[model samples]
Each structure stands twice: as C-alpha cells, then as structure tokens.
Target: MSNDNDIRHGRHCVFLMHVHLVFVTKYRREVFTKEILDDLRPMLASVCRDFEAELVEFDGEDDHVHLLVNYPPKVSVSNLVNSLKGVSSRMIRKKNYPSIRKKLWGGALWSPSYFAGSCGGAPIAVIRQYIEQQQTPH
Candidate 1:
C-alpha cells in the first residue's frame, strides 16, 4: 500500500507524483481488439517499470488508451510519454504488424500528440463536493 504523499526516500530528496496519460491511434482508427487491449496492459506496465514509474491503471477503447502512472519528479512527463509511445509502437508493430499496418497505413501506431495531466492532490470527495455546489445558470 502507498500513501497519498507518495513520499520516496531518495538519497537527495523525497517526492511523490502521478500523471494521467492518453494515447490515440494514428488517424483515430479503431485497431484494438479485446486481445490487443489485454496485450497492451502488460506492455505498458513494463514500459513504466523500465522508467522507474508505476502504472497505476490502464484502460481505453479501440482507438485510444488511458494510463494512470505514478512517477518521480526526476522524470519528465513528455519524455516518459515519448518513450512509452515509441517502445509500445515498435513492440505492437512487430507483434501485430499485419493488422496494425492495415489500419494505420503510415506505419505509425500512435498519433504524434498525447494528453498528460498530473494526478494526486486534494481528496476526490472534497473536489466532488466543491464541484457539486457550483452555481450554474438556470
């Protein structure tokens, strides 16, 4: 079990951080099947581990995937995203070249851009309540 603080005792400092990542398929094509999604989870988890980060959660539909990752401050989010995308792209291509090639057409598995956001801050309940109480135009 981990704490909200995610405080890691490194030689120089302690830090805790998380990020939500989204990767879309090239041309927004629907290429992922149930078997592919299943294969992707572990592949992504392995990538995260290689980066010294943790894959908190991984799920998505046919054209994209959402990954919740806990990473240290030393790692840049963009770099992580690039590595994740690059490695997975190659691996998936090698494994499922025929199907992926047919769908993507450009030999690219993922689009150039991705979405990444920091996670783990204020409690979810508190944030939900704050949102729920917001006054909106009727």
Candidate 2:
C-alpha cells in the first residue's frame, strides 16, 4: 500500500504513477555540458507542468538524460515524451552552442527511440506473494 500523501486524488479517480525516462542524443553525440544540463532541467519541468505532471528528478550525461516524472493517469507517457523532446530540442538549439551544433549535423536533438519504465511501489515478487496468499471465494 502506498502512503496516503503519495496518492493523488483526481476529480473522479486516484493514482500515483511515475516513469523513469531515458533519452539519448541523436546519433549518440556527446553534446551536453554541465551548463546545458542545468538549462535543460527547467525546460523539462516546464513541459511537465504543461501536462499537469511533476518533474521529480532530472540528470544527464554528455550523451543522454534521465527524468523521473510523477504524472496523472490522464497523461499518456508517449505524449509527455514527445513534448519533452520537442520543447527541449527547440530550446537547446535556439541557444546555438557551437560545440553542440557542430557535433550534431542534423537539427534533431534526441534519438527517435527512448526508454520508459514504470517505477515506485513494491517489487514484483512481493506483489506475487501477496496475491498467492489471497483467499479464494467458493
């Protein structure tokens, strides 16, 4: 069971959904610097806000970024990913970091593919055991 505070109450439903998302740079280019990642954090948060979600955590390496987002059930992961990639890409490119632009010949910032995993809550084994112990109705 989740803590009561952790659960979110919507107008007609309750949910607590989190996704760990990983986005790699186009062609796996190493373009992000500390300054770039700093700038990116707020951009991602803003995008999440637009979707009525919260960006709980964010970090990145030169080649990729990881985001932990808490979202409502109404928001689809695909749509959120699209907005995150699109908005951040445009914003980053607009800054015109010569090193980044040079490395990425194409205008695209992220690869077409991404990794998203549902996170938080009990481990699968625990859930399985609990289900197995349940009493069946006659």
lDDT of each: 0.85, 0.93
- For 25-99, candidate 1 gives per-residue lDDT tens digits of 998999888778888889898988888888888899989999999887788899999989988888888896556
Instruction: Give the worst 10-residue stretch by lDDT in candidate 2.
Output: 1-10
Model 2 Cα shift for residue 8 (angstroms) = 0.9
lDDT (10s digit) by residue, model 2, range 62-135 = 99999999999999999999999999999999999986889997779999999999999888999999999999
Q: Looking at model 1, report the run of 10 residues with the lowest lDDT sum.
A: 1-10
Give TM per candidate.
Answer: 0.81, 0.93
lDDT, candidate 2, equals 0.93
For candidate 2, the per-residue lDDT at 109 reads 93
Q: Measured by C-alpha RMSD in angstroms, how accurate is candidate 2?
A: 2.6
* Error in Å for residue 45 of model 1: 1.2
Displacement of residue 73 (Cα, Å) in model 1 is: 0.6
